[model samples]
Target: MNFLKSSVGRKVLMAITGQLMVLFVVVHLLGNSTIFIGLINSYAEHLHSLGPFVWLFRLVLLAMVLIHAFFGIQVTLENRAATPQKYAVNRTLKVSLASSSMIWTGLTLVLFIVYHLCHFTARLTSDVASYAGQVPGDVYKMVLGSFQHGLISFVYVAAMCALCLHLYHGIQSFFQTMGWNNDTSLPLISCIGRALAVIFLLGYSSIPVFILTGILS
Candidate 1:
């Protein structure tokens, strides 16, 4: 309890949660990537095969997102409150766009997450609801129908950009915060982190792009 109340502890919590979220993203991408191989329906079947446990899995996923987002907002606010007034012309010598705009990027991701849940999971909208019922339990066809649209795919790609920026800074800083990296290795870690972020961006963005371009259909 005491440790969690400390500044360093909060950062560590954020780092840990960030890693968990990253892992989830990677796993999710792999599952969603089944579309490329025509295994998406099988994948969805496996998930639905979980029976009542599907709800449990969803509850856990929801918990992960809430905990991560809660800590993220909390830490950002704390940092801003602790920071003193800065110079009129802040030096850009060491600052990067992702590092400087963590708050905004984070909030953007949060909003995207909510919309994504409603779009796919709940299938509340007319278009998505139509797809959900087009071929009962056909996750692939449903995904195909929804992503075939110009606007939906565009939003997905845009959201992925926000995710890329978040991971670029989040993953690099996570290593430093966890003491898993030293100043000498920081540059290399940053390079590796950037590569991973780009991979994720390309991997995820590819889906919607391919769908929109008639390549995946």
Candidate 2:
């Protein structure tokens, strides 16, 4: 319990939670990529049938998300508090805008997450009624149909943009929290962070772009 009260403990918890969330994202991205293999429905049904334990997974994910967000906000607030007085000497902010401005990007991502849940997770959609008495095509059809609209595609692009920014800062932070930071290894970690961020953003963004171009039609 004493350890839990320590700053290092809180950071460790945050890192663990962040890694869990990243793993979930990786699995989700891999699952979504099945659309390219022409078995999106199979993948969707597999996910949809997680049964009662799905709720357990959701709860775990929720806990991780809230903890990570709370700790991030706490750290940002602490930084702000520490800088209550302006320094006489000119000094650049130690963090990047992507890192410092995470609260706004995070809020935008949360909205996107809620929108995604409404459209996919909760199986709610503008055309849900049309899917009545239908089989478990709930997930696939919604994603396919949403892309038919230019606005939805644009929303996806924007969300992916924010996500990439979040990941760019998050990946390296995770490494540092894990005690992996070193002069010899920091550059490599930084490179990996940028590469992963760019690749994920481009890969996810490609889906909406393809749809908007009528390639998926």
Candidate 3:
């Protein structure tokens, strides 16, 4: 009850869930990278074959996503309430656009996630047109086909940009939650967070780039 009642407790819960999702992203990137290795079809089919297990994994993933989003919204609302004159207090402030615009970018990401699920996890909105009705037969082709379209590719790149903004803050917050924010270690931690954020952006963006360049077509 105390944990549910306290802001710190909610933040700790969010940090734990966020870190778990980050770990999932690392594996998801590796799994998706098979498309670059010339084994796209096999990789796609492997994912497709998970059947009930895939749904179970998805359920867990959805739970984590909801928890993270809920706490994040709560925090943002509380911040707005606590600082009614935040803009007035800093009329000339020039924060990083991404940092100041987290809510907008975050909404974009949420939409991207929904579209992504509809495209892959649900197969409700297929990218069959780009593949010329090839049907992909596996994960690689489906994913590749989705990025082959110019509009879709741009969407992915934009989403990756938003993801970079989210990670830029999220990663450091995670470390701080684990009690690693000290003067001597702050710079090192910040560097590591930036490095990881850059790697993630590049990794996720590479798929769209590869498709757009005709490298995988």
- TM-score of each model, in listed order: 0.91, 0.89, 0.87
Ranking by TM-score: 1, 2, 3
Clashing pairs in 1: none
Tens-place lDDT per residue, model 2, 1-217, is: 7766677888888888988888888888887888777778898677668877877999998898888888767866776787757778646667687786677777788788888876666556674446544445654566677788888889989999998898888888889989989989999998898788888888888877877787765
Q: Lowest summed-lDDT stretch of 10 residues in model 3?
A: 128-137
- Residue 122's lDDT within candidate 2 is 56
TM-score-better candidate, 1 vs 2: 1
Quantify all predictions' global Cα lDDT against the true fold: 0.84, 0.79, 0.79
lDDT of 2 at 47: 62
Relative to the true structure, candidate 3 reaches a TM of 0.87
Candidate 2 residue-wise lDDT at 189: 96
- Give the per-residue lDDT of model 1 (tens digit) for 1-217: 8887887887887788788888989999999898899998888778778888988877877777787778778887887797776867756558899888877888888899899977777777666787554323777877888888899999989989989998899899999998999879999999989888888999999998999899998
What is the Cα-based lDDT of residue 177 in candidate 2? 86
Best by TM-score: 1
Whole-model lDDT, model 3: 0.79
> Model 3: per-residue lDDT, tens digit, 1-217?
8996688888898889988988998898888787788776776667757778977988999898888888878887887788657554685376666557766666677788998876666676656434433334556666767778898889889899988888787788788887879988888887888788889999989999988999777
Q: Is candidate 1 or candidate 3 better by TM-score?
A: 1
